[model samples]
Target: MRDLYERAITAGGLHVTEGSKLWEAYREYEMAILTINDGNDEEKAKQVQRVRALFHRQLSVPLADIESTLAAYKSWEAEEGNTRDPDSQVDDVPPNVLSAYKKASEMYNARKQYEDELSVVAESEANKLQVFLKYIKFEKSFGDPARVQVLYERAVSELPVSSDLWMGYTSYLDRTLKVPAILKSVYHRATRNCTWVSDLWVHYLLSLERIRASEDELRHVFELAIQCSFPSMNEYLNIYLTRVDSLRRRMPTGLDFELIRQTFVDAAEFLSPQLGIEELLLLHAYWAKLECNIGKDIAAARGVWENALKKSGSVLEVWQHYISMEIERGHTHEARSLYKRCYSKKFAGSGSEAVCHAWIRFEREHGTLDDYDLAIKRSPLV
Candidate 1:
């Protein structure tokens, strides 16, 4: 039976590591075939149940079968979920030899051991900076601020410029202590050699706002962030707006908003493709948010949303807000069309399933009287 299973694995054209579930199912089917060949009905029945269970568990079932045994399981419906074609061809081996699974398992074990050994040797402060960072992350996740000080101090001393650690540490300060001086120091350290980091610059700007830094300080931070090339121009666009908004709030007549807004608009266009999908959406979203609220250019605000959607299709949050923006402008038909377009593209990946659900709820709760039907039609079950 095991020998037949080996032959069936190769015959199915499935690589062991690449399609482990399919390979396992092929092996089980081979066992079922052998039991039937030996005239053991009871054992064959058990094997059938096992094969059925395998089919139930997998989202991407293999198209072929064990030599000629493919027709026995037609009850299963295959969904094209999370499956990618193998990049390389399958390896062939003699039926008597089980080298594929053995070789792959051995290689995995060796790699795991190497990682474990390196982890053990990396127990020093410099090496375990990730651990301290992780602790800060845990605290952030739970919204707890107790160990933030300890984490921040140790992280700076051990891994001063590690952005993940520094960012995490500074975020704790922002959320818990709201200490302007600490935020300033963190920004300086975090961007010492790597200035293009948008989060670091933004946090620094925020800390400045809290501390009431002089216009000179604000402009300095702005220049430093812009010069660092750490963030795409699109990201810089939003950050620039944030600075403008803060300045306006603190001293409305002190600074020029139109000049800064123009600078950011040019920057966003220049930095469009260089940014990631999330950053790009945020850039335009913030632009639209700022402009629409301030009564600057309604057409430009709608245009910003349109450009963002074109770049990041089916980003539901953007779509929902874009829909809301259109509906607010009495463009109900446009909003309905946008909502449907977003709905059709929402099932992007399993990782974003939660985001998809949130978007559905957002649309349902905030959708206008005329748009609610289409919104509900597009929304999936939570």
Candidate 2:
């Protein structure tokens, strides 16, 4: 029976730690044994030593009601007819041990109010979530990492479908713990519960990449993310962007550009109905920039921009972004040509004036004096 109690205390982990009744029961059992051998002075001495040993052990652990246990131990010493203080009677006791007990008692007292509030039955899941969040915050601020993790586990178990709770837990694990296996487990569980949350899937994919998981593993998770029925086109876009970015980061020089191009194609096909002109243009811009910068394939980049123009040629922002990209890549002639094409087009937007000013600025910086003069003359016509 004593062996069973030891197992419960040691192997039960955090759940049996905070405010467990096991300590009290164990102490009572020791006292009962002492009572059974009442008149044997030698046996009584041994029992007294055993009881004191139990108190000393309990004091070292940071239990929730440590102060009460300490008081009980002192009272027991007094009842055993020890006149001196309990601390002085224990010759082998370390000074720091008592100081640590006092610190643990203070920590428990500070945590009691939050624990009390959390124990009450909440009216709704949202209220419960708020309470749990507050408790988690308090634990993070004042308690050890183990306590914080336990609080997160408790929160997620009760609010499994809460994306916010899952996100917070996974994020804390990612940022604080960085234990790959634990992170993978929590992410898998979180995604299973909140599959519709695109951000969670995105973060999961990034985490897998961060830990340098195999290419097959990363692709498998990305496929799972794509299969989720996300609420918006942007969510799908984010997943695609994250996957491509991860691929780029993993193999910056030897990346298979064809695979990336196929990803862009797949994104376009999957998101066509929901993709607005601006989103379409932004997607093409990202693809073109990757081609120009990473692949060093100017032709492929130009092809992407031309495809974007076919889709959103009338949007002034598209022209500006395309021209800006060319200028940034030192393709001055291409930028000038783009500016000319944009000026010739009769797009419906109030940004035409802004485009003309940008063109004038571009020519002043990148073009010759005669070219700058020509741009100034052509600005009003544009």
lDDT value for candidate 2? 0.80
Candidate 1 per-residue lDDT over residues 1-382, each given as its tens digit: 5566555444332321234444555656654564555578787566655665443322132222221222222322122121132221122222222243344345344334433433574657655675555545543564535334643564566566577777766676777777676567767877784566787788878778777877788878877777666434556766666766675575464666565567557667767767766666666666776666664677878888777767665556666668667767776567656655555463446524544454455556666655555454555652
lDDT of each: 0.57, 0.80
Error of 1 at 143 (Å): 16
Of candidate 1, the 10-residue stretch with the lowest lDDT total is: 74-83
Off by over 4 Å in 2: 1-12, 16-59, 64-103, 253-255, 336-342, 350-382
Clashes of each: 1, 0
lDDT of 2 by residue, 1-382 (tens): 8898776555333332343577777788988998899688998899989888888777866677676777777778778875466654343345675776777667667767766776775557887899888888877886467677777887888789999999999898888888898889999999999999999999999889878788888899999999989989899999998988887786664668777888888887787568888787778888888888777899988988787778677788778888888888799999999888887566677677777888899988889999898889888854
Off by over 4 Å in 1: 1-125, 128-155, 172-182, 193-197, 229-255, 275-282, 299-326, 331-382
Q: Which candidate's lDDT is highest?
A: 2
Clashing pairs in 1: 196-230
